[model samples]
Target chain A: MKHTLAVLVENRYGVLSRVASLFARRGYNIDSLAVGVTEDPTISRMTIVVRGDDLVLEQVTKQLNKLIDVIRVTDLGSEDTVERELALIKVNADVNNRSEIMQIADIFRAKIIDVASKSMVIEVTGDENKIRAIEQLLKPFGIKEMARTGKIALRRGPKSV
Target chain B: MKNINVYEKYDQQSDRMTGRTEKMTGARAIIECLYREGVDTIFGYPGGQVLPIYDALYDSKIRHVLVRHEQSAAHAADGYARATGKVGVCLATSGPGATNLVTGIATANMDSIPIVALTGQVPLSMIGNDAFQEANITGITLPITKHNYLLQDANDIPRVMKEAFHIASTGRPGPVLIDIPKDLTTELIDFHYPETVKLRSYNPTYEGNIQQIKKAAEEILRSYKPVIYAGGGVISANASEYLRALAEKVQAPVTTTLTGMGAFPVDHPLFLGMLGMHGTKYANYSIQESDLIIAVGARFDDRVTGKIRSFATNAKIIHIDVDPAEISKNVRVDIPIVGNARKVLEDLLKYVDKAPTDDWLQRIAHWKRSYPMHYIGGKDNIKPQYIIEQIHEACKDAIIVTEVGQHQMWAAQYFRFSEPRTFISSGGLGTMGFGFPASIGVKVARPDKVVFDISGDGSFQMSSQELATVVQENIPVIIAIFNNGYLGMVRQWQELFFDKRYSYTCIRNSVDFVKLAEAYGALGLRVTQPSEVRPAIEQAIASGRPTLIDFWVECEENVSPMVPAGAAINEILDLERKA
Candidate 1:
């Protein structure tokens, strides 16, 4: 099972390496990981997509709690959460196919960040499924370039993630 | 770009502990607590950042034993904890010294020995700046330690310190590191010690689950060929009675891990010699062929289990351990009853029916008769194995600690330990420099108990700097070095697998061990003949203070009944012994 754990940690230099090392030593894999600062300057939240069974994730969470820098871990898959991922897809779209791609992007409420004669950069933000759907639509147009920020999550209602 | 708040622990008007307010620095408060905790002796080394703590120590009544290396402090602390049940304390400066303590801390962790390690950190402002002599000691030690604390503020000292000792000594028992920023130790604050720790996340289940206990009981009662595989947990949990009861009730044989040696009396019929590499042949075979393996507090380490795939392949495995990380981490357990080993065993014994198994007992007896743990170096010449056995005979009740490599294994193999905690070695971490300091810790813990450190020449050199600490403290510990002049384990590997291309295994500049001991204001004995073994050991033990005995033995000797790397436990190699 893939678990998306959004963790808040102190911005220590080797904090990421410690987390990665823990996963590596424990024989677990990180599917995707993204780290960015939150409102609190000292605290940087990391969104990590890890592959493990429920039991493995529970053990991993317990071990991570032992790390001084890691404050808390939230498994978004098991909770009612708002998940977002950003991707800049440079599509190989000529003038003719650019209109079709723009129309598809408009349906998903994705923004056209950049446009050139040979390619158009489509910026999309959504949950994993929505992002995958958008990427599939742009695949036929020949993806020339791409960059993705892995899933970032926040719990719903009056609660802190 | 951002406003920096003056980082401070909440200075409540009433104080953390109600009704008392006394001004003191974190350094002073910690020293006061240590004094209150009855720590008369400390093993440590001074440094630039920890100078304030040393300054406080001078004013305090405690006697500090300065070691040549910081790593020695940690090992001494570990040895002390094992010797005495109290928390062993050691202190070191920031950065490299803290990193040097890693081997000792990990050694303590692997053996489940309780230790309190103190490290100085850079000033709070320069923590992440990578300032001079600043390393993330807390971060470096996180994975190996049970718990660690970074003291950023002065006010939280007493509470943090008291809890550090508490957590290190409680539950499964392991090492805890406390990294103190130099500035905080010097900063004055109102001292307040919280009576209780309000850690919501740490709710350790000490008594254990009744249902799982019942399941363990059911499994034990149903099995015909039962074998009890024990480890350091028995000693850590103080569950000797529980172990005896379970063994007596079922008529099962008990074989312990290398660290678990003294948990059960070696003379007991149910007690099989220590299992795994160089273990009793029958013990390993019995555990591998048993119908049910009741592994109490023993993590199926690679050395003990050999290849995990075929480790007790046909048997039903019921594992009981306090640490949750142990469960399913290596070999999957059919029944993982997680809790304190003593409590869980006691709880399981409650549900067990009084059914005696004469069949299992008979089979174990047969196996023992067929393949016993024995080696006859039939030659009359002095050998390391003979000296270890002679020393064992001399100090039957004494606590024996060992450094890593061949001698450690030889001591484990030859020393017939019949008392609990009598044999202490760095089993898991295999730290080469473990013995002398550990002996110091042991001697400090039990002043009345005789302590002997079985050291290999190569391994002893790593931390022998503690010779100064031993002399300074005036604690008597006999260090018997099996002087093979080679890193015996590595030498064996080189001879067998690497076609005898000896590299760094040889000790190029051999020190006269007798002169070495004399230099440290201790007695030294050099034994070259078999007749000299017993006399030298007796004289050294009788000499009072620290003593070292150098026994010149054959270097080509190999540890037998070893399961080579990545091999199954049953596939053991019995190396040919010299006739």
Candidate 2:
């Protein structure tokens, strides 16, 4: 099972390493992790995707709470959450395939952020499944390079972590 | 001087009006924080990086014991902490000195000992440059430490020190490290040690959920074959009195993990000796046959659980621990109460009554009688078990510390500990050479008590250089070396499982421990016969000096009533049965 956790931590040096080190040491598999400062600059929010059962999730939450810098951990798995991931894909684009790639990107509401003589860099933002679908359609065009900003999420309601 | 006094008075007034802020160097602030924390002694060895701190200590009252090795410093602090239930303190310089404390830090971490380790680092500008004696100590110790800090500024010293001590001594206590750059110690700042720590994320759950406690109580009252499985948490929480009361009230038998020894009175009728890899046959049998197992302050370690699937198959388990993560880490429990053991047990006592366990007790008694711990040796030959028995007979109230090996197991088995903090050994990490120096720390902590380091020849040699520390400081501790000419535990494993291939276990005719003791200006005794064991112990106690007694015992003696690795706890091999 995959669980998304929204963790609020002190925005201080070595805080990331502390959280990451804990996951590594305890053998918790992290699927993806996105970290950035929240509205309060002194604090940072980390959206972590982990694969585990209820027991492992409980342990992960408890262990993360044990770290001194971590303020709160909420399992966004059960709650309605708005999640987004950004990916920049540089595809091999020539005259023959450029129009097809543009149509696929348009259908997904993705944008062509950069264009070269022989290639185009497509920018896509969506949930994990949507991103995966677009990548599959562009696979035949040859993905020259790809960079993904791992999933960042927040609860749909007004409650905050 | 007059201007300074006036400034001091004004500073005091403003501080009293505002808070406790005093102008001092970071090094002096560190000492002041220790004084505030009521730390009386520190074990450390100084080097170039910590010179300013050493200089600051010149005017401080805290007694510092200089160890021969940095590893010994950490172990000594660990021993001090175990013996006194206070957070022990150790220090070291950068690079190799800080690295030397790694094993000791890991040892303390594994066993959950409360210790604060301070390491001197290279200057801030030189840290990542790999300057002389520089090490990224905080990075290296991140996994091992409960928490760690690398001070980037001098002003953070007081708060960091306060936080370090607070973190080390609280809830499921473990070692914490504070790595300070050399320049910070010399930098001056207004120091105010925080009166309280306000860590939003680190509050430990002290009281168990009332519903869980009620369920656990009901389970206990309804159980007919209840067994109390205790561990290091009992001692850590100082919950022995509550544990004993609960056991007696429920009329349940109690079995302890190796580190859990001394948490329950070993002489109590309900008490079953240390339970686990080399645990007593009766303890293992009771667990196998138990219907309700009440686990208190104990994680079901692999050694204790054996094959997890086969462990307590017929039992409904109630696990009470302070750490929530430990509740189902190794084994699932029907009732998991996450709180301080003492608090949970106290709450549990409110709703529980005597249990119906007469038949269970009778069965346990039968197992105890049929499978008693024993070894076969004549009067002339000194069996290691007999030596342990003699030590128990001689120093009935002594604090027993042991290094890791077969001797450690023998001491754990043979010595009857009736009080908490009486038996100190490296239970989790099982680090060798932990005993002798730890004994020094124990002696320092409890100067009035007789301290004994039960060591194997192999283990004692690991930190034997600390004999100099003991001698120079005039700390009298008895070191009993069980000289069997081989690493007895590993050798036993080879003899049983590996076709006796005996890889590198033999260390015969090594440095004579007796001369090694004498050379350090301490008392030395060599005992080869059973009769000599008692006299040697007596002489060492009487001498009131650092003494090491080398006992040449049978080389092939193995700790019996053993469960082979990965086997069920009940599938044990006794002396009459061999694998």
Predicted candidate 2 versus true structure: per-residue lDDT over B501-535, tens digit per residue: 99999999978989999999999999998878899
DockQ of candidate 1 is 0.25
Residue-by-residue lDDT tens digits, candidate 1, A116-136: 899999999998888899889
Let me know the TM-score candidate 2 reaches against the reference structure.
0.96
True-vs-predicted CA distance for residue B529, candidate 1, Å: 1.0
Worst 10 residues of 1 chain B by lDDT: B1-10
Which pairs clash (backbone N, Cα, C closer than 3 Å) in model 1?
B79-B441, B79-B442, B80-B441
Any runs in candidate 1 off by more than 4 Å, and if so which? A5-18, A34-47, A52-62, A65-83, A88-102, A111-123, A133-147, A152-161, B1-19, B36-38, B128-130, B377-379, B500-504
Residues B269-297 of candidate 1 have per-residue lDDT tens digits of: 98888787667788888878888898988
Candidate 2 residues lying further than 4 Å off, grouped into runs, are: A94-100, B1-19, B576-579
Docking class of 2: medium
lDDT of 2 by residue, A30-129 (tens): 9999999999999999999999999999999989988889999999999988999999999999988889999999999999999888999999999999
Worst 10 residues of 2 chain B by lDDT: B1-10
